[model samples]
Target: MAHPDARGNPCSSSSLPAREAAEQALWRLMSFYDTPLADLDAAMAADPAWALPHVMKAGFLLSLTEPTLAREADAHLSHARALARHATPRERAHLQAVQLVLEGRWHAACRVWDELLIEHPRDALALQWVQLWDFYRGDAHGLRARPARVLPAWDEADPLYAHVLALHAFGLEENNLYPQAEEAGRRALASNPRVPWAVHAVAHVMEMQGRFEEGSAWLRQHQAQWAEGNGFAGHLWWHKSLFRLEALDIKGVLRLVDAHLSGDALQITLQRVDAAALLWRLHLLGEDVSAHAAGVLADWALGEGCAGDYAFNDVHAVATMVAAGAHGQAEGWVARCAERALGAEDARRTNHLMAREVGLPLMRGLLAFSRGDADEAVDLIYPVRSGAQRFGGSHAQRDLIDQTLLAAAALGQRRALGRALVNERCMAKPVTPLTRHWLEKLALPEAAQA
Candidate 1:
């Protein structure tokens, strides 16, 4: 007998215990908690003939964006495929999507999930996976639109309703819909305070609006909920560090790095990305972060095998290398990225297009800035500044490019350009202390009044 999942979607599992175990794993995954894999293993052990657990396992591994894990993911997908004959249409669709993901076709996989959602609007697994890929692809429109499309079909009393609201909140925040985003995020927290993604979405709204103090207070207020035993703890700490950076509290940012962002804790690529981004920000502010950068660089283990697999990861790898003063390695990595982006075989991959159009230039610009070629940095980054979203990251993550370009303009003594960029930022948000400091550094006429 097929079991209906939490959302009443039929799952291809005859064993009730296996179905229950898979549901628990799905909850853990949707909540961003650790140990989903263990539950999944239990599910598979409960019923080796079930396909849903195998499909879920494959999706989880593929989402990590680690090339080395592809084979293991493929193995799981094969198990799911072998059981496809007994699977429901939804389960079969999931198998197809995982296969696409293993093929390095993320966009197509997302489409498969999209179609699945259209047919099964209550499929929380499909909703969560697609939202993550939308984020990874920098599809702000898809982020906001997809959730909006499926949200009406979700009942507020559903177990995963808060998670869906949190996803929508992030999408809204990413699209610059601050007020609506905050309202939705607060609503999610009101429903369930442990939703870290809701906490993260609200934080993005604060960061973008230059609510530095409020942002710090917000993260600190939710520290107990988001920090303990949560997979997103490192990223929440990174958000706290961003607030500290804006306040010019370099020491405080360093303290956060030491406490949460470094050492053995930096195990995953996401955590490493956050560490490198924080370190790179410090480096841009004229701070000597060589020691920390060296640690992050060492953990990156950059090699030909992983090169250009994901443009976002490649960009951060280069940032780590540059911050560590490994200019030679950084240059080589950039060259490799260029070669991969141009290679005929890789040209069909989505990441190749991202690398060629945005990632390569951003890497080159960061390298130029590190090498004291401010003019080259400005030239390389300025043209792509508006479309930096193409490279895939939140506005906060992409701000490093803006910061670098502004710094390049000021340091290179390009008066007109420097003033223009300064004014642009000032107009975007109220002049924070950091913006005032940049004005002073640029010797803008308004610096005296600021």
Candidate 2:
């Protein structure tokens, strides 16, 4: 007998309880809350033939992006494939999509999901999965536009409608649609205040608009809602730190780092990258945070075996090593990236090109800055500033590269370049004290100062 989920999509689980539990878990994953992996375990134990439960398990594991979890995803894939012979076409399509993900073909998997949605537009699982893959690939347009494509197919009565709205909110923000993004984010939160992604979307709006004090307060007011059992806690904290940095609240930023951002999240690659980024921001601003840098670098040292797999991680690893004064190791990581780019997969080859074209130069520039070669750093970083987004980070994260270039220009007394950059930044935001400070230091035209 064929089973269906709440939306009447074919599922392989005949057990009603198991199907409902798996559906709940999918919603939980979409909300960035801890999933019910144990429930799927129990469902599989009760009915080894239930394919959708295995699909959920495998999908969840693959989404983690932890190298160790990849093996577990493979095991689940084997089980799901064996049982898929008797499952419905929808279940089989999902199984195939997940298999592509397991094989490291992210874009291929996204295409599969896209086709699946064309027929079964209410498949929340596929909708969320594509959004996740889009984020990992840094597809800013896909982030906002994918959800927009499906807007006509969804209504407020749907169980996961708020999740879709939150996803759209983030996509809009990433695409630089701040006003509309905030409207969508607020709507999502009104539906469910616990939607951390919506909160994060609004945070991005405030961050980009230079609403530092308001951004800080927004996160703090909502901290209790998202602080527990949420996978994005560290990331939200990282956003808060950025707000503090902009406000020149060094102590507040350091406290957030010590109190929340620097612990277990370090074990996760993406979160660890956030930690490295925050610490690098502090280092760039001349804050003495050797202890924090040392701890983060030690964590990176432990994960050095996985270097060069992703250009994004490689650059963060370089930041960690450079901050710790491991100049040789930093260069070695860049060399490893060079080797990986040679025969990389189609999905990863773009990242490889990004590493070669922009990441390597930016990293070398950071390294030069660390070694007191500000002139060389400026010479290296200024040329490739426009291409930094190709390296697979958000606008906020890639801003680190530009910040390093500014640092080099300031230190090397490149007055003309520094004045122009400062003026550009000041014009973008109406009330940026930090940029104003730089303007004063440069003794540039007061008309350029905000």
Candidate 3:
């Protein structure tokens, strides 16, 4: 006889103990907490025929996106496909979604997960996976709205309901619904303070609204909640450093870098990106962070070892390499990214398009700016401004590209473009010190400020 999960979702395995253990492991994995992969291994050992463990493992590996992990994920996918005959229709649908991801059709995989949610709204794994892919695809509208579509199906009684609210809050924030997003995020945090995503959602709202002081205080107050064993600790610290930078606390920013963001840059792409981004922002502001950036590049083993196929990582690689004065490596990165973009299959053709279109120009621009060729940098980046969103990154992360443009415009003394861009920023973030300083430097008349 088949068993049911804790929330009563059907499992095809006859071994009830193994099924329950696998369910627990899945919950941990979906929660973004330190997942007990060994528990899943034990459950699979208990009953090798149980398909859910293999399916979950496949999903986890596919999400990692590292080339080695991709190979491991493929092995898991093959095993899951072999065991799909033993699973129920629902589990089979999940296997199909995993197959789509393995095939590089992530959006199609998301659609399958959406269908599964429509049928099994309580599938935490499906909801989390879909949200992750939405972020990776830079689908801001999908990130903000998809969870709301399925939220009515969940109740406060559900075990993972708060996490769903956190997802909704993040989506709302990304869609520019700051007030609603903040409320939902705070509610989720109040219910379960350990929800790092909820904490991150609130940070996004605060950051967007220019509530830098409030953002700093909130993150500092809640730091303990998200500090230990949380995979997102570095990112949360990165957000805090943004708040510090906005406050003109350069010392604080560097302190955060040394205290929190310091690590092996090559081991985890996220940490490397964070380190590079933090340093790049300082570099754009004309701070002397070449040594720090060089330290970051020391670990960046590019070419075959790195996951350069991810356009997001490719951009950061360019930023750090340029900052470290490794112009040759940056150029090589651009070329390799172009090759990968052109060579990608139809499923991820959009990523390839982004690489060929925006990624290449952005990297070349960075290289030019680093070499003090401000005019060349501006020339290369201006035409690609509208297409930056085609690559996968948040508004704040992508802001680095625009900042490069602004810096190049100013450095090249292209007063017209500099005036236009600075005024636009002023209108959007009227109280921002950086914008105000730029406006003053531009010597724009008082009426133009209004």
Candidate 4:
């Protein structure tokens, strides 16, 4: 009694009502909105023998990258594995992928999903999960390639087609294909105005292109659709703040921080990561953001036990602590990252390699920058700048590392390096007020002369 899901893939559920509920959850997951977990719970309760629902739930929880949710995700994985006898081959492959993620073999799980998609190209769940982990692992090439591979097999009229486009759009943007990325993202929005990821992709294109005013307007134009009833609202607001920062609208940026990025409203780690990044940027610009930094630090401190699980999270947590002036706490956080990198049990995980290679140095450099050891910060961070992608974040997010190095060069009176860095930035984007400010701070000549 197999049932076809929204994407026309055969699911194991026999009950119509259960299938409907699962479809609802799948839509929620695709849109990054509403309560997918509740819908998933209902689906599983209605058909206890169904394994796809359990796999779906497990995959969603694992995507959060929070160690506290790992146990819950594992429980769902166990349920899916126990019912493997009843699962379709596609479903069973999903079970194996989830198991690999649970075991901290993210790259392996991605490969499993790749194989599954080759067999069942319309599996929306597989497409979404693999794209997510690809982003998490900083495989920018895979981000674009994975979705591009299965997109031709997807019917244009399918409901999930637009979401697939959104995924591909993001991938293209990550790989620096700005024109193609924007085109794909707009096409997705044309199909479904409520697609946050499409909106996010377009936003990224504008952000990278230094179209600050247009980026601000674009986000605001779609704010009504993505600003509520979703988990991604805080991040959208954070993106808006970046536009504001570029315009040197310091007051406007602070207003957004107060209204949305305060880290006081939501307890999600991703939101807090945005908060730390925004606050840290302001700190770098010589603004007194100690109060906001302290609030973000408090939220991160509550999850202190999960510090070393992911290098990206660990770096953000350390950034918050450093920006908050918790020097001792920042040191301890770096120590934990070092410990995880060297520990026998953690050594086998993909994140351990990430920590050892890039995370530890970045965190230590940030701490040094905070402590006024500008030369030491420059020494530590300059070497890892090119490889920062290994720690897994968008180009905009990883720009923090470069920003720190530039500031360190200026502070340490490394005049030649400072001028070169400033020149590089000027060449990348049209010089804005912020660029001029940086130039002035470093006492460099105007953008043209530099």
The per-prediction tally of clashing pairs is 0, 0, 1, 0
Runs in model 2 deviating more than 4 A are: 300-305, 343-350, 440-443, 446-448
Weakest ten-residue segment in model 3 by summed lDDT: 344-353
Candidate 2 has an lDDT of 0.79
Model 1 misplacement above 4 A: none
**lDDT tens digits by residue: candidate 2, 1-450:** 677788878776778777767777887888778866877777777678878778878888877666567778888889888888788888888898888887767777888988988888888888888888787677787788778888778878877888889989989988889999999999998998888989998999998888988998999888998988888888999999999888878898899999887755576777888988988878777877667877877655345335555667777778877776778888777776666665545444345566677777877787788889988988888888876655666778877876777777777868788877876776667657666656665677773635
Report the C-alpha lDDT of model 1 over 327-401, residue by residue, as the tens digit: 999999999888888898745577888888899999999899889999999989888888878778899998888
Write down the TM-score of every candidate.
0.98, 0.92, 0.92, 0.97
Error of 4 at 450 (Å): 8.5
Q: Relative to the unseen true structure, what is the C-alpha lDDT of residue 137 in candidate 2, on a scale of 0 to 100?
A: 70
lDDT of 3: 0.78
- Give the alpha carbon lDDT tens digit for every residue of 215-301 in model 4: 999999999999988888998999999999988899999999999988556567888889889888888888888888898776553
Task: Judge candidate 3 at residue 420 and give its lDDT.
Answer: 82
Query: How much RMSD separates candidate 1 from the native structure?
Result: 1.2
Return the lDDT, model 4, position 15: 86
* lDDT per model vs. reference: 0.88, 0.79, 0.78, 0.86
Candidate 4 error regions (>4 Å)? 301-304, 447-450
- Model 1 residue pairs with clashes: none
Q: List model 3 lDDT by residue over 1-450, tens digit each.
A: 556666666778888778767767765665567665777887889889877788788888767665457778778878888887888877888888887877667778888988888888777778888888888778888887778888888778766888889999999988889899999999988888778889999998888777889999999889888877767888898999998987778899999998888654235666788889989888888788878888887766564835346777788878888877788888887877766666634536446666777888888788888889999999988888876766776777777876777778768877688788876666666466656555565566743444
- Itemize residue pairs with steric clashes in candidate 3: 144-171
